[model samples]
Target: MQTESVKLPRLITPLIDALTNVVVIENGAIVKNTLSETALTITNDMPQSLIDSLFQSDNPVVQHNQKAAEAAYTFKITANRTLEAPINLFIIQKDRNMSQNLTFIVGEHAGVTVNEYIYGNDGSTVDYVSQAVVEAAGKLDYHGIVNLDAASISSINRMVSVKQDGKAFIKTAQMGNGNTQQDTRIDLLGPLAIGEIKTVALSSAKQEVLIRSIIEHKAKHTEGLIEQYGVAADESFLMFEGVGKIHKGMSKSIAKQHNKGVVLGEKARLDANPLLLIDEYDVEAGHGAAIGQIDEEQLYYLMSRGLSEKDAQRLIINGYLHPLEKLLENDIVKKHIESLLENKTA
Candidate 1:
């Protein structure tokens, strides 16, 4: 598909420029697929057996979405290669219900980065399912951005499996203006595997948002961590849940979970749960969570400095989310996230 013939959204234009490879899925169909300057293969079809072998899940939503997907895609990275550029995958849902499934395969010793963005419009509903498999010594860095229209509804499920010495780093930023449920799971299936998941979210205007992340350490010397931060305002509801599990006989494995949330309005509700399950006495596991409103003293101090109440609130919200910039490699994508937060808080 020609890039010129298909118009791109204004909010995503800056990010597309920074990414060398781009794929666009609109209304449950592939509208544009462009590839360049990246050592990756993009395909629309994969054997059912291959898909079943790479991904396994008991989540009903994930299973249903996988079977009912209107568009399915696979992105395969070359073995033993390190790619400096990130691949951009954009999904646009407008005026209709849509389901999509995406799979990513990282070959042995390969390193790759992926950035995915989902945008909804005209009260559409979206079901998004994704699976990733990392081979031995492979590394995958993934970032997901979810910004939907005020009346839209979305359900997102993502799963990953890492082999020996493989590592997966995942960070997601959700600007919630509608109803959204997102679930993520990572399994360290081989010795010395590592997984880390982080989330930054903002919910406002009566939106209901829930984000859950789970990491399982199934092999000796494996490590996993989950961290989440969110802000809720204007009668919205926000929940963050994290789970870390260390299986029996996985000696020396480590699992940790942390979650924090802030409430900006009296009616806004925020909840967090940090859960850790350990079956091995030799492993280390810990979990912690905190949920509260913004500190009144901090707001008072900022307002005393001649800042308006709204401006002070915005500054505080920015401080909570600005840490995400360091985790992102692309400056354009970082700025895009900042803009989204700015608009959401404003």
Candidate 2:
């Protein structure tokens, strides 16, 4: 129940103003929370070595966010502890560009859930980076929603690691009339680790979006799943790239990726790429991608039920994105998705 707010001096005074808010609660009581510009205020029991390892990632987006970050938040769950409720993070941008970083660590035998929401004004830009690590037998569930105004830009990057017997689930929904680029990477670093990533995006009004995801299996008996769904309208462009890789020594590992997209307008464009790079002989890996316009048969069936063309199209799009909503498991997020769909259809 601890709430804190921070304001950072922007590099460009007239164009960007940085602001952040954070809240942390444990066992129905406020534990520790502070907001600052110069340093991250974290009160957690995780080891220093575990925190340092997250910064070693080589991803370009991660590097960019880290280099430009003006505010940071870190959350750690004690060993064998379970959070009663998910940690909620809300970020808002007014008229400026901003960069922020977030880190989550789940100790051995602990379980935690986190939900992040980002909203910004038109013409604004935001760069966000997040890293999460689940220790041996730990569990982590993360859900995110991005909603920026038209003409704005958002870049989101995330990295996750699962240790021995750990489980991690990441679900994201991106709904904006602006441009967005998101990259997420999951690493299975211990035996029997499990990871799942699901993302749904809706782009319209000349917006351009790129969603890239990678799942790496570096340990034996690991399992991973990646799924992406997107819809393009009004000349908007969308691209989805999913990559699954199994190291040479990783045997008995299974990885799968699926990417699908639908075009809602004649000028809309969609590109999907599902790739599997396996160096192990005893691994099971596969990928599939499908990009095309809405199914005419489905549309006809919906129209026959007395729905208008616009209504029918909306129904189709909803069906396509329904799976992602289920994965999100949040009523607020589901309402946001419905609102966005209404706007897009209007």
Candidate 3:
């Protein structure tokens, strides 16, 4: 007999129009083949100082795509009212010299789904970037969960843009300790556009994670997919770069990437690079990666079903981070990510 359920959080709505206007720029540049866009709705009650360009004063912190996560925050939206799910942003840095920068924008067919979590790492060490632009048949689902504890330092980067038959989905889950470091990225263009990205990471003692994923397939039936997984222990480290490209007159484009890693100890480490570039050709791209440890017949079938391999590897690394928290469509950001994964801290 085991019962403990008291879940109630599922009320997400936004899209109140008064026509719409929101423009935020700092440490900026948006002029490349510009169609000029800056709008927002939801009863147009803006002006929270657009996060003051993330505490401006010229943002910096580059080196492995850090660029100080510029803009810090310029949250915006447009398209009257209608957001039945997804929207929870939290960044907590309990003193010790903290910093910030965040940017968010939505327009076109206007649909929203976003959940971002970045817990403090003892301050003076947080650089992030969150960007999304999906118009046309607009749709956006984004979730980035990061938890750290130790000396400090954390870096995160995200980018998504799909016009035409727009649809973009991205997810990243990172948990670290032992002196942190995390770098991530994603990009996909338009034209019958569609994209899906999933990521998971956990590095114990002496942690490190560097991941970069770029999928750019412009036009003609564009589609992209990427999946990332990881687990590491003592002296932990991981680096992955999965890039897919198809330029000129991309026809019937298709791209794929997969990365996996598992290392328990003995100075754990992993590096994977999946890259494919095609100028033009009825495209079909591919990439797969793997780095491993921990599979003694799945830890002797979880100690012969008695449950104990440290709770069976923490139930297989939280079942690969519970499917991007079921693609959070709000529900109080899925109960604050189910109370931060039942207080598992990651």
- Per lDDT, the best of the predicted structures is 1
The digit string of per-residue lDDT tens for model 2 on 53-103 reads: 654666666666665566666676788887756655556666677777777
Q: What lDDT does the true structure give each of the candidates?
A: 0.82, 0.75, 0.59
Model 3, position 59: C-alpha lDDT score? 26
**Cα-lDDT of candidate 1:** 0.82
- RMSD (Cα, Å) for all candidates, in order, is 2.7, 6.9, 18.7
Candidate 3 structure quality by residue, lDDT tens digits, 87-204: 5454544334333545555667777766665655343366655556676777777777776555567666566667788787888887645244444443445678888777877666
Predicted structure 2: lDDT: 0.75
Query: 1-83 in candidate 1: lDDT tens per residue?
Result: 42442333347655654566787777767776776745787788644675677676788877787777888888899899887
User: What's the C-alpha lDDT at position 185 in model 2?
Assistant: 86
Which residues of candidate 1, in runs, are more than 4 Å off? 1-10, 13-19, 297-309, 326-329
> Over all chains combined, what TM-score does candidate 1 have?
0.91
Off by over 4 Å in 2: 1-52, 327-329
Candidate 1 Cα RMSD (Å): 2.7
